[model samples]
Target: MAERRPRREPRGLGWDGREFEVTVGPVAHGGHCVARHEGRVVFVRHSLPGERVVVRVTEDRHPGFCRADAVEVLEASPARVERPCPFSGPGKCGGCDWQHVDVAEQHRLKADVVREQLVRLGRLDAADPVVAGLVVEELPGGALRWRSRARFAVDRDGAPGLRRHRSHDVVVLPDCPITVEPAARAVLGRDWSGAGAVDVAVDSAGVVTTTRLDRRGRPTATRVLRPGADVPEEPAGRAERRAGGRDWEVEGTGFWQVHPAAADALVAAVGEFAQVRPGETVLDLYAGAGLFGGALAPAVGAEGRVVCVEADPGACAAADANLADLPQAEVWQGEVDAEGLGELLAELGSGPDVVVLDPPRAGAGRDVSRLLAGTGARAVVYVACDPASLGRDVAAFAEGGYRLAGVRGFDAFPMTQHVECVALLVSTAR
Candidate 1:
């Protein structure tokens, strides 16, 4: 109890602009490669693994770690390629992450990220076949022009552009290479003097719809233009989409896959994993437009039951319409949290044979995953966009006695760090 030491103040302004040379380590989650500098971890963007580069610390708020950009490359990996988009670079448009990487290598890198997340966060064994043999399949469309739906931020002066990395500043662009030409043109081709942002989408029929939102993020105007038409046409109520051998109607710029080919690829993977039999009950949680429920309805037959639960009313309505022809399929609009899911399971009065969930980027949280696993469903098919979220949820499922069966990844969002994963978890008792 001798003399008390004076309180130490927190350090401020770390190596924010410090520059250093480092050998980049393996890629980590969130579109960055790991590197070390003086015992501090540096998350360097615009850099590939196993390369020597000079990194400029862009952010240094944390004491243990910092964020940087590879301003100069001393040694480049073979996977490095000339960045195709002029708007993309270390401090430019933050839309695409792997534009400088070769297309094939981009797929491989995504696969590596998926496996690493599962092993590191999910606590799965690295030697597990599902983790060891993972691969990111390339969609039909190449990396460019795959983005069919995008939101462009509008600056105060009314210029529309994508946001810079972790920044609110909009980088005005003539066109976004990753986005479909028509969709990009609809948003970037014109200026919205008063809008804060614009949402644009090109449907399967090539109808371009743009919705202008004010600074508060409220929709101010909506316009629809048919293909090859310069003038605005009557509002195209719901954009039409085709997936799983049928046409679907979704709200303009709604929750359909940004990549045109993603739906088909995901449907095939889900169907193959689900293998729903006749007279079985299936739950499609977070169902958007009843894509999976409607697709499985035919396989389940009239005796079987398919329930699609979604929180968004608009999406639920679209799901209802999409599944209208299939009497066996029904859409329920509600939250998919632990509490809501429990109520849903109780109302069903019977355990589902298979549970399919395509949660948002945040993934189905641990509570929801545990509750779903407790339902004793034979199979749980998880469609995840974020690897960290998937890993956390998978770990929660494991606690509920589910084992990792298999997983497949899709390069749905090429040129970007985002990768879509479809994983199958089966009960150990099964």
Candidate 2:
């Protein structure tokens, strides 16, 4: 006999199917703004602050609040705009949240959310000028077609699409304008039935490679697809990128900035903030493909030492090849937590003059920040993708006697709620 499947019990706050009009309040952290209906807190999406809208509750599983999407705007905000993507809506593609808002207003909303998260969760001062004057700057193309990389889910029917909000159901995406031309051509209108998912990336040379992952989540094959060509079945291997005035070769599936201008922008920002000089010892933690490490090598000069630590073996190998020109640069493979970082520092026998860490979305945790604080580095440049995680780690850094010196936000993922941040911290004892 087949094993019995466990039944799912109904869970809700008694407001699941409710519909009501709400006056949207300030923007919250996760692509939504807070509002109240009949004294019950509501988190509404697809709406802007100061707008009066009628919403349909999408989720009410949690106590005290229900999640909703604005169905009809009785009084629309000035920033409201016609959503460009047909897939974006109340129950459609969940990829782009702020597509309904004007591009400029989306920046403002993201900036507001970043500031609020830092101040509220990180306990950063609201009166701080840098925190208060935070703004999300756009890239070269403004907001359209900036993504050089995109991943799509494969539905049971073998169609490549994006998942719906809070769901595993794939929303068919025949076209996505936000992706770079190469990536857009690779997956859109393609049938990926043989794979569980597909990742498409466009290198600086404009070559688009698509990697199809099997149902077991292993890469079945990867191939370079010509514009409007069908997906190929052979591995194309590595791709080259030019950034920080140097050449970098990474695996077709490696972690590189998805935005066209992100690598240069971040390298410049970190250099300006950290100000690494000749003879300085620099540490690049979580250094993928040596983007930051390569940039710092020239600044630190022949007399200086630049060490790049990466947990991924493939990324470390890529970093090694990318920074081969710099005699002073070295790559160490390991995690970036207290134990891993501590052992590496001991091996170096001296502390770094400047440290740059670009950890994953779950920003370098408390233990990592605490370890970094004791390293005696004069400056630490942190590149964060999630504000909440950054805020939490910033608080942890404070406990290690480091202070938040400066932070800059970027609207890298336009139309989406994600924002990139580069933070500079200084040791109080330095």
RMSD of 2: 3.1
Q: Please provide, for model 2 over 62-87, each residue's C-alpha lDDT reduced to its tens digit, 9 standing for 90 to 100.
A: 67788999999999998999888888
State the C-alpha lDDT per candidate.
0.93, 0.88
Query: Candidate 1: which stretches are off by over 4 Å?
Result: 1-13
lDDT of 2 at 317: 89
**What's the lDDT of the predicted structure labeled candidate 1?**
0.93
Provide the lDDT at 302 for model 1. Answer: 89
Per-candidate clashes, comma-separated: 0, 0
Which residue pairs does candidate 2 place in steric collision?
none
TM-score of 1: 0.97
Cα shift from native, residue 276, model 1 (Å): 0.6
TM-score, predicted candidate 2 vs. hidden true structure:
0.95
